[model samples]
Target: MKRVALVGMPNTGKSTLFNRLTGGTARVANWPGLTVELASSRILLGANMVQVFDLPGIYDLTGGAEDEQVAQRFLSEAKLDAVLLILNACQLERQLALALQLKALGAPLLIALNMVDEAKRAGITVDVAALSEALNAPVQLISAKYGQGMAECKALLTGIFSNESHQIDFSNIPSASTLHQTEKQLFQRSVHQPPILNQSATDKLDRFVLHPWLGFPLFVLMMLALFQLTYTLGTPLQDYLEAGLTWFKDGLLVPATANLPQFWQGLIVSGLFDGVTTVLTFAPIIFLFFCLMAVIEDSGYFARAAFMMDGLMSRLGLDGRGFVMLMMGFGCNVPAIMGTRVIRDHKARLLTMLTIPFSLCSARLQIFLFLSGALFSPTQAPWVVLSLYLASILIAMLTALLFKSKFKSSEPFALELPPYRLPLLSHIWRRGWGEARDFLRLATTMIVLGVVLVWLLTNYPTQQHSYAELISNLLAPVLSPIGIESTLSIALIFGFVAKEVVLGALSVITGHEGQALATQLAHTLDPVSAYSFMLFSLIYIPCVSAIAAIKKESKSNLYTAFSMAWSLGLAWMVSFIFYQSARLFGF
Candidate 1:
């Protein structure tokens, strides 16, 4: 069995290469010791059909960082037939470090110079032969994004597979410093002009975005505007999707079920079409959110926001890099999990992952907008969403404080502010497509089934009445203190799986109980209780996929369980405190 491995530095297009090679069956995974996770995939090699491993992205194999340690351990253990090291042509100096270290493991190696398109665009030239001689390995240049030179690189690897006997080199790696000496020399001699310093442009923009006194307030304002825009824009698209689903149900399902027997009818009308359509109807909102985040990321202002918030994070004993993941979490948690690998500290990385769920993700925000509008006044809407975000930040602060007091603080973050680039619509559209695909593939597939299962359990009755009433009553005693001794809270609990289902569950409960149920709930539970309910949702176990990710990333049952338990416990206390205290204050 021929086994090949691929390794590279972060953002060197390692994943892009993996996607190109392995045909995109990649999944996120965690290191053995650290909670930080990475993405990997398998690729099929030429005629021999050899196996290839796409390893985690790390800057070096020095074992100084958790991801690096992981790559190092894998390299040492896996008896790989050949290793492919990807290096970003633009960032040659940094990406080369990991490559040299891998070469020292005495394996047949090849360097795929990625981002050649960007390199040429940036006016950087490379001699592939010189680089090959420097590292004593076959070197080829390719761009995974544009597909330039990728075929030649594949052919070269095919040749390696055919020969099955290439010289292995360790001349570039050194035991003492974790880097080979020649690797150091080549980088030092790689004469590229220093990075462009956009001082004037930065000074102008910082006046608003990074102004010491105005920065935080500006951030709040921007977030408020985003929420307003998202709702205003996303609502129409959501309405269209919902309308389409309604038509499909009425025209397609009703006709299809008219002639079928109950068993076949149920399978088509409820299990298959009903389940898929319910989840797919939310695509518009998800699509909008993805597009927005992609635009923010490409413009380079997202990183600037992290820089602006550094002091706040430092005050709470966390680093700014954690904010990067938080911003990503709002779009989807999958990328957020992958983002944590950027953090170098093991403790900080775990803490950040633990707290990310508490941030009101876009999925949660969709539910909030619906419920907040249903419960609150027009003037109070912004405050409702604003309050939820503020609560998320506060909870994050508390989580950080608890973590730091329990463990040592990580190294402070130092972020380089890259020059802002205009958003390329093609790139933004592609990134958005990737995120939209994730929402549908990873989340919706399970969520629709979950919703259908919940509908059955809640709709069907065992004793005198439907199970929904029985469940509400059983939960009422526990929920009575918070004033939601009814099915809404029952649905909220089920919502812990994924937030989109919250609306469906609420619709089921409220529909079963009728319009009178809303009036009754409104009277029994004041605005405070509704607000508390939303807050409880802000901090709970994420969807099944996120939980699975936690298991994979922690690689330990205890940490995963601890993460789930702590989140649930904290959410309960926070909700209880808000509800009970608001009742006491007579709100």
Candidate 2:
């Protein structure tokens, strides 16, 4: 059996190539650090089988950043026989440097010229014969998206077993010969052309987008366009999914249970399916959103966006690299936290992870859409979304400032405006399915338990009164300061597990326990109160999964408790100020 490792920079499509080679695609994007863990699989060549490992894609071999350093040690120390130095043929010069360093480790190397189709489409040619002659080993042209050179890529590695014939033995690693001229030529021969751009197309874009003169306005335009696209294209469908999920639960599930015993029916219809599926009913919107983001990423526009944010990112004591993680936070924070392994600075990484939950995720956007759609005018709904996103950035930056970490951003990073290739339908499906499946699995587990527990709390009556009423009455005074009534507090309690539950719980209680709380709030409060309530809802408490993630990542229950407490406090303070300030301004 043969062993192979895929190596490249972040966003260099190593995972994409891994999928093509091993028939295993774990979600890919233009975003960096998606593959933080090393994934393994088996590949077959004729009758022979090969074990393959897909380690995290890193920009350099230098031991820095958590994941990159971890990967570096893996390559240098692990008992590996061969490695395929995957290169973004379109951006070879930058990728070639890493290839050089990998070759320095004395492994039997096959240079896989990945994204060849992309490079050719971009009017660039990689003279592979010249490349192989210069590199001292086999070089193959491949397009993972199209599976063009995969067979030859596999064929090139068949001679690795015999030391006398191959002259590439494991004992050569770390020997003085490791840095000899033959190794240097192997590194140099692996590439034909330099990076695609001289000035770096990203620098040109960054000069404008990160410009002190125009950056903010351009940033606003980009964000506004993204939000508008999501809501404009997404709102009708978001509403549709909600309606369909409701119809399934209410029109079908509810009435079917009308014949069953009252308790049994509530447990089945409302508690199990309604509670869980209703929260997950927005899967289509989440799926569509992941698709939109996937297209942006695959088309290579996202890297430019990250480059543009470097100036502001640097202000927050992080490099342009950290911007990618923050952008992923808009999708979800868990992956964003995991992605921080790309950052070499531990303090900066922790701060970036801590601040991501503050970013407005798509889950919370549904709440914004519902409120602004119901309460505010249609055109203004977008402003609410826009403001929340802007507020998140503002909050993230302000909080990052409090930590006051000092860092220099002088890395020799180059950008490539490679030709935009058509996103493969299979690639899109593979990426989207991985996330959607994980989400469904999660919905069935944690959120199902949450809804069932809420049902019990509402159904089980205490000696004095109903437990639901007791819960509502108890939280009434606490939420009263922000003008949120007992019903909303009850909704927030369910939301302690996940934000998606707040609306679902509200929909369920519209007729019963929520009635008194709703009436009292409506009579006493105004729109300002609603705004404060929405703001509070957005920032309060890390969800059950988020807390669990914090504990896992930070390795401290105390840290998780502290994070929950501070965010909860911040939510209250922010909501309190906004409500009182709105009143003082005579709104």
What lDDT would each prediction earn against the true structure? 0.67, 0.68
Candidate 1: residue 526 Cα off by (Å): 6.5
| lDDT: worst 10-residue window of model 2 | 161-170
Output the number of the lDDT-best candidate: 2
Query: For model 2, what is the error of residue 58's alpha carbon versus the real structure, in angstroms, after optimal superposition?
Result: 3.2
Give me the displacement of residue 234 in model 2, in angstroms: 3.4
**Prediction 1 global C-alpha lDDT:** 0.67
lDDT of 2 by residue, 1-587 (tens): 66677777766678888888788867677656678878889978655677788888776665456787667667766666577788777776456656555555566788888888756655667667777766566888888888898888877866553332222233333433333554445445543454453554555766675567786687677677766776677667656765676667668777788999978987776666666655565566566666666776676556666777777777776656666776777777777777777776556666666677787776676566556655666687778878878877777666666654532334443443343446777777765566667667767776677777777776777424668778889888888777687756767887777776665565454432122323433444466877787788778885777777766766777767877887798889888888888888998
Tens digit per residue, CA lDDT, model 1, 545-585: 67777777667788888888988888878888888888789
TM-score winner among the candidates?
2
